[model samples]
Target: MENESVLIRYIKTKKGLLTVSGILATISTVVQFIPFYCIYKIIELLMLGNYSAEGLIHWSLVSMGSVLVGVVLLYASSMCSHVAAFDILYDIRMDLLQHLSKVSMGYFSQKSSGQLMKIIDQCVEKMESFIAHQIPDIVSALIFPLIYVGLMLMIDWRLGLVSLVPLFLAVAIYALLMGKTMKNNKVKQYHDALEAMNSNGVEYVRAMPAVKIFGLSVGNFKRFHQSIKDYRSLVMEWSNGFRSGYVLFTTLITSVVLFVMPFGAFLISQNPQDKTLSLTVMLFIILASGTTGPFMKLMYAASTFSNVNEGVKRVDEIFAEAPVKEQDNVTAFSGNRISFEEVSFSYIPGSPVLKKVSFELKPNTMNALVGPSGGGKSTIAQLLLRFYEPTEGTIKIGATDIRETTIDTLMQNVSFVFQDVTLFNDSIEENIRMGNRIASIEDIRRVAKMARCDEFIQELPNGYQTKIGEQGVFLSKGEAQRVSIARALLKNSPILVLDEATAYADAENEVYIQQAIGELVKGKTVLIIAHRLWTIQHVDQILVCDKGEIQATGTHEELLAGNPLYQKLWAINEETKEWEVK
Candidate 1:
């Protein structure tokens, strides 16, 4: 795929915006000469008017018309540029998201949410500037100065040519200054890193309780403040560099104008050989001097150009990433029969997590995945649903290898209830109905009752309509879990995966949730990743995963008698339960 972003490449592909953009840029470029033309016409009226009333009115109206036209063109130019910019940005965002779907799960695991946010923010901001203002502005800025210079040359070649001293000097200084500014690429890197840290820091700060529980929020305030200070100091350094560069460039430009331009004007005026009246020589000096608008701005706009380029590169990388697959073919699953063969995986190379692990799950069978930390039990469930591809093996759904099938095809018939549930800041019913958006109110109430959610949901101030707040903070942890289960039940997929959703729940609520799980799993192929021993006792088949391979796979009684690791884990969990009761 081309590295060019959708904003740049899309217009070429569509050619729809190209015409409008060209028309707008042309108008802006032509209107740039209005100021030069007006200056010449204004000076003529004033010089030849003879202090007449009608002459003053004539000049005033002409001056007013030029000013009005310039204003109108500038405004219209800005509007057209902005329109084109936003249109491109809209297309780019959609394309970016669509490409993101192809990116493998490993890519997601390797990136931080904060870093992702910065890429998104910077991309949109830079593309906006490029499309809305920079392209046309750069074009007009470059040509306007040349246009002014050409007009002056037509008036008097010697004076027009000499007036270029300031423009050349300014450009020289501007180029040198820009070189110095470009040396601060390190500053850009630091800024992006800081933005990522800030984004991650803010999210964690809001979830302070979780951090405190895990004893992880220790260096937040100090780290965040220091980062802020560092970012401020870095920006200040870049600003000073840019400021010195601009000032030096503009000063040299102004000096050339003051010293060289007027002297040339005098020389041209003193020419006794040709007497068309040297009036235009003076006009040439003023108009040619106006060329510095682009010259002086080069130093400033160059910084924005660099920053925008960096931003676009970051966004373009994401937009260019190969997605998982494009599956416009939304196929439905017939029935869920999960299978794994010669499955091998490693989050990091040379550190294998699952090696040659194989498993077969019969349709509508309840199986419990029992394992210690890092035992790859959760990895199995994640693979069964194609959250990731096996590094060296095959996982199949029905008769098709998951990779060969579209993600939507498998996912449409699978519902996942994770340990941590993050609900929206909307109504309870809305969150549950997210599974089946068009589900009727009666359907929502029916699923809630089945999942034991209606009893508490009805207790809320507005019942189904009550806002849950972010992550459903308005409800207790137990209630959130119930809402999650209700969602899965509403989804009513053929296969369901539960990741210890009952872990932090109280005894009564845990029992209630377990009952709801049993109901939901009645006719579905259920895969459970259990952290505790008691969870697997009711499962039809229990796989005791020690490291990567399943050491034992059988009923609870069979595993307890035959598998040593299974026995040890069972005894340990029983002791812990007894200790809890004591």
Candidate 2:
């Protein structure tokens, strides 16, 4: 595979099919010249004053038969190429998807959903056009001209040389149309504009609610509006630049006979009695027009190369990314105790979010991370779940480094519930089952009841079968949080991480969710990241975090009794509790 072209490597599985297609296309192109040759023979016979019904009929039938055979071969060639093209597209997309799954979560943070979608959908699809249509067209176009020009030269070298004048001019015009500037600057700009438009359009849709609440109009949404403007301007600029050059190329290619006719006429007059020479000039007149078809196809194929090449390079960029490294010799853990030994992390280099942070969760004990906003509580939970690796130092479960075990092995032991819940547009039962794929319907019901979502779920029109998201019933914030708990409960992992699980809950829902959480954490080591100090008052240990460092650790009573940051947080929490809307 080394030094192989991206396109050829992808299509190698169907190389034999493409080879067969190319052979058929070449034969079809050669057969297309039969009608021209037949017309020439008929004209030659007439000029020599040789008249016979059999001779005319024989050449006419051969011309018609060659055309029919050519049509059949061309059809076969197209079929083979199209089949190979679609299969290769499927393989490429699957490979991309599998690779994406193995990459770090950080990769997704940097890429927009729209950008990835364009690469997977539009960029990959671009290859289909090149492989299916252009490959065969290019092969036939290249062959047709060489054969046509060669036969003309054999008939009359003078007329053959004249026929090439328009072809040369047409090729020159085409070259200017597909110059380096058009390829590197214009085409790249067009794709960039398109990607920007797509990304902004997605952002605009996702923020539709905020826009409506703020009374914002499309014109006021500057990002989306500017994207549309730039896209329109680039398209106009591209089309205008291409329009004249394409017109000139087309005129030169199609009016090839005009280049041959005068020269042909002058040669005919040079020896009017030379019937062979006269017939040859007439032959060039009739066939020169037909030659335009292949040359025109060649121009079109060459023009498309820039766009397809650009898209292919974009696709290649995705394949060039490195996925998350996995352990070769996976180490087995001996217990449920989780420890972070002076672990430090940062999403970007040189800006530490967790500086020399260390903590231990004794097996089966409950712990809470209570901190102010931007104090790295959520980051600690994410680090434990291996959503990201520590920049320095080790995170171990029972004495084994988390990195020494496979991701699957690490994830199986730890369950995390995020502040933001993501539920698919699927049945409530299906959504919960994502936590445990092989869980039976009865097991799902048991966990749903434990998470306190079973009551509301049963009240829905279709109960557990009811779908969620846009096309179905939308759950309230608290109801969705309960459903997320139901998933964690089903997983029943040894350790759990709750990241502000009750942050969005109402008082009544919070009571029910707490009762559900009481059931979910039984016999499991737990870590709760909470902003509400009152919610974590009864935890076994409270770790006070501030400015990327663990400042203090104590029970609720001890922290409020001594630590200033803890006392201040508690005072603020108490004040907010007594506030009223009036």
Candidate 3:
């Protein structure tokens, strides 16, 4: 409801377009009464006096002109309203996107890609229906109904009261049936759609290996089909409720109109001397059935607009998210030194994952954060990136706390390459150029060639212009990683966060990737989180983090000297990688 009010305020801001649409709407509604007035005047003149054919023709022409005016107004209103609606939707989506960008990385960890996408979809749908359909329909339909009811009362209050009984029943029934569904139906439908999208997205990732082992050329579509079937069942339930309710309401409106209309005509004729009862007013009674147009229009409007409620709820959920925090006295970067002083984090409160953890990395040095699985190694990089704020203590870039700096400023010095290698379904040049869109084509190509993607990119059918398919699906894991390295290299930030940047590489590819890393680490501060033993061997320092604390911190050789965990893990991996057996 707050979202609705905000949307209304936004729409009202476009005064010129809304005013035009309103004027058009008014013209359309006024003409609804004009036709009855025209028939009464034209017919009475013929019955009473000379009733010249030309005079009748003149009245008929006026009526035709009114009809034409109504048509023009309707068309204009439709066009202008649609324009405003689409523009509003576009602006709302942009606003939501901007808000999402401004919020901290903590928000993303708690939100799924599918859920956010669902929110976006709902925002668009709500704006479209409210701006495009609901507002205009309310004016057009409600005005006509009020005019009909008012005129009926003017003719005879007694008959008017009688005439509205079925409508009263219909309105009561509609409220009982449809109003009961207002809240839950929208929520149910929204979650159903979200579940379907999430399921499909997850299965798309998880079912890949099985697909390849079976030599399947295309992804199995059964999961997608099941999701659709589930959605269909929910929709059917929703539609059935409205469909049955509509039939009942329409029948009641019809029965009331039929009973009251004839009885009123009979009552009027009994007293033929009541000359104030004009023929025009009498025709209104005859056309009382047509008066149901407004009620029918309202019924139709409710049916269609129920779908928009789900959209509005989704939009509301997005808008409810709090904005990002702002630190008043932000500390700017001092140098490239990184440190964690008893810093720790957890996804949920109370059950802490990382306890009081601390470490420091010297400027322009390679530091490896290593441990067994479920250790807090990746979590350390996540903290440096400020994806999740530490639960306790502090993380500092240079000598300043990360919390003391703005996110953009903090990230200004950061270039993180994670396990996933996601590229847009775009050209190789454009994908790498995302590091900095304004970078020169020459620089982009230089970075690409440096990262070793230049060799394979040139071999592609479209060379640098080759489309990488969705998420770079056309490229193998190692190939995609090289492209990602090219992106980070082009970024040229002071701090680098590399998490398994060479995981997919073969021996030859690994050698090339390591050299790329060597060039990457020349002057920038680097933090490495890896499972591979080779990645940790020659780093300037190694911090083994587990369960949110630094279990050991020293040179790899020094850790093997003192820490049994580090020593045993190293022996296992080193033996696994030995060139020859004893």
| Ten-residue stretch with the least lDDT total in model 2 | 175-184
Q: Which has the better TM-score: candidate 2, or candidate 3?
A: 2
Instruction: Enumerate clash totals for all models, in the order shown.
Output: 3, 0, 1
Residue pair clashes in candidate 1: 102-323, 102-324, 103-323
Worst 10 residues of 3 by lDDT: 275-284
In order of lDDT, best first, we have 2, 3, 1
Per-residue accuracy of model 2 over 228-296 as CA lDDT, tens digit each: 999999888778878888888889888878988888788778888887777778888998889777887
lDDT (Cα, tens digit) per residue for candidate 1, span 1-582: 455555567556534454565465556666656656566666666666555667656666766776677667666766767777777777777767667666777787866666676766665767777767776667667666766677667776776667776677777777776677567565466557577566657666777887788777446556655666677777777677667767776686665457545676567657844433445654665565666566655544565677777777777677656676635665555458888899998889999889998888899999988978888988887777766777898877787667766777777778999988878899999999988988999999999998998998888888899888854438777789989999999999888999998987988889889878877898989888888778769788988887888887899999988988888988889988877442
lDDT of 3: 0.77
lDDT of 3 by residue, 522-562 (tens): 79888988778667788899888777678888998899899
Candidate 1 vs 3: which has more TM-score: 1
RMSD of each: 3.6, 2.9, 4.1
The candidate that achieves the highest lDDT relative to the unseen native structure: 2
Among these predictions, the greatest TM-score belongs to 2
